[model samples]
Target: MSISPIAEPFYADARPIGPDGRRIGVLLSHGFTGCPASMVPWGRHLAGLGYAVAVPRLPGHGTSWQELNKCRWADWYGEIQRAFDKLTANCDQVVVGGLSMGGGLALRLAADRGRDVAGIVLVNPAVHTERKDVLALPVLQHVIPSLPGIANDIKKPGVEEHGYDRTPLKAARSMLAGWKQVRADLPKVTSPLLMFRSAEDHVVDPSSGQIILTSVSSRDLTERILEDSFHVATLDNDAPMIFEESAEFVRRVTGP
Candidate 1:
């Protein structure tokens, strides 16, 4: 598959001058149907601050929606796991962050990695949905191939997420199933967590945030509400705040 130039994966390795004199790494993932375009800017910002950063293009993403339909949750998670492994091998400390479904993937990594994940930052993470339509996905996926697009839910005038124009049902079903597993393992996530949620999100509902806040065992947890952004807060009006605050969070959590 020919990937779009803007949606290409991004990675940068930098030497660290932290208190412990150890390299710090940040691994970021984009949402379902969304490509690395949604995360490359944030990764570049962190890289500018002299941190090693990686934003990987998940399998079946950065291509067509029909290609995405052929993928399952494991395919995406495997790519994230590979990226995380690479980051950990090069850095003394690693932090994970994500947007939307990427957030769920981050949480799953935190849960599985335990203390290896120094911290986590989430923007409009989606783990559960209140939509009743999801209940019929199993039956609907066989009848139809997709639904309307859920990408680019940003309030910024000209910003584009560069995500799929259609939501593939088979892929959606796999993602929803993955969410259940992430939710079940939430108690295992003990790393510091900073979550940025949009006050008026059109994609993921508030229940996802609520579920995460109430379930995770992280002692250092913070949630910031983006009043002006939508589901894709990472590229919206409040993106600067997310970037700065997340950088601060990473510094504090990975410091000696």
Candidate 2:
């Protein structure tokens, strides 16, 4: 399958003189079945500020939904881990961010890597869902390959998220299962955290935000509610707010 131009991964190198004479890196990831296109604007905004930024296209994403069905949660996490390693190698400090499942992946990274992650910024991150249908996934995945997609949930008109039109069942099951482990290791995520959530998100319910805020051990935690957007707030009316506030968060956490 030919990759769409918008789906391509985005990268920006750290400048020699970054925040306080130290290079700062930001690793951003897209959600399940969603491509890097959703994060490119945010990545570019950070890069323009001289931050090394990497937004990786996860395995089975930016491609066909059938390919996504063949992948597991670990496969996506491996890609995020790889990008983090490379970004950290080139910068003195690193902060990780993600949207939806990508946020879950960032939490896993912070949990496993410890203080190496300077901070975390998440937007409508999903660690769990209140949808009862998920209980049928283990059996349904064997019976079906996919369901209708839950992408492009932005309230803004004409804003495309470039996510798969179908939600692969096998992959969905894997993501939900991985949430258990993330929840268990939440205490290991001790880095400063910032999260932005749309008050009217139709995709992720409030339970997800509640779980993260109550579970993570980060002492410096801030949660901001977005009133003018939906699930994909990164590209919606509140995007500028997310970008500017997040950039400020980066400076405060990575500053000497």
Candidate 3:
């Protein structure tokens, strides 16, 4: 069997329209090892509201496991920054949002950009964790080897599961390093934040959500729980909740 699953292709790209007619744009980033495919629905919903949305595939993602392992957090963050800048150029204002690892990057950008970033939305963001699996990255990097697996997690609406058939240790190591950096920098972020946490996320420590709640300087932070979903809550039963809440957040910040 192949060591990595077949590469999944992206269906679209960001398109700019006339500046006078543009709505506020959003840059949506997917979780580690996830493709833009996972965030398509969320992007489509925002676009339906007359907002321009950009979902860029991170480096080494939606391609192959080998490519993913080579990617670091900076690569992912750079991708978001590029997209964010592009969106801002086309629209009057911009919001940044992401799922899982993507959420961490979004927070970092918002924190660093400050007033430049209009708002943020984090879905099951990985903020901080004491989980042994996340900590085992160093040892597993040398001992564990690659295994055949799918790139994305599959969860039905309103269900909970451990997530992914196989976890890539090197990739996990890179992500944890990135999260540590984000944790140290959270205090600087003052943009309004909207965070969604799942009550039954098996992949991340429950306290992960709480860390974000307490750390960020965004006084307008709002927290909600998707009780019926798991880590990938964006795809679970609470997806509509995610859609509604995020849409509302953009509306409140940008004023429709």
lDDT for predicted candidate 3 compared with the true structure: 0.76
Candidate 2 lDDT at 89 equals 86
Q: Give residue 63's lDDT in candidate 1 (0 to 100).
A: 89
Better of 1 and 3 by TM-score: 1
Q: Write the per-residue lDDT of candidate 2 for residues 66-128, one digit (tens) a residue.
A: 988999999999999999999988899999999999999999999999999999999999999
Provide the TM-score for each candidate, comma-separated.
0.99, 0.98, 0.86
* Candidate 3 structure quality by residue, lDDT tens digits, 141-202: 88874444433343573332222345566877878888888888899999989999888776
Query: For model 1, what is the C-alpha lDDT against the true structure?
Result: 0.95
**Given candidate 1, what's the lDDT at residue 210?**
99
Worst 10 residues of 3 by lDDT: 1-10
lDDT of each: 0.95, 0.95, 0.76
Ranking by TM-score: 1, 2, 3
Relative to the true structure, candidate 2 reaches a TM of 0.98
Cα lDDT tens digits, model 1, 132-207, are: 9899999999999999999988899988999999999999999999999999999999999999999999999999
> What is candidate 3's CA lDDT for residue 230?
72
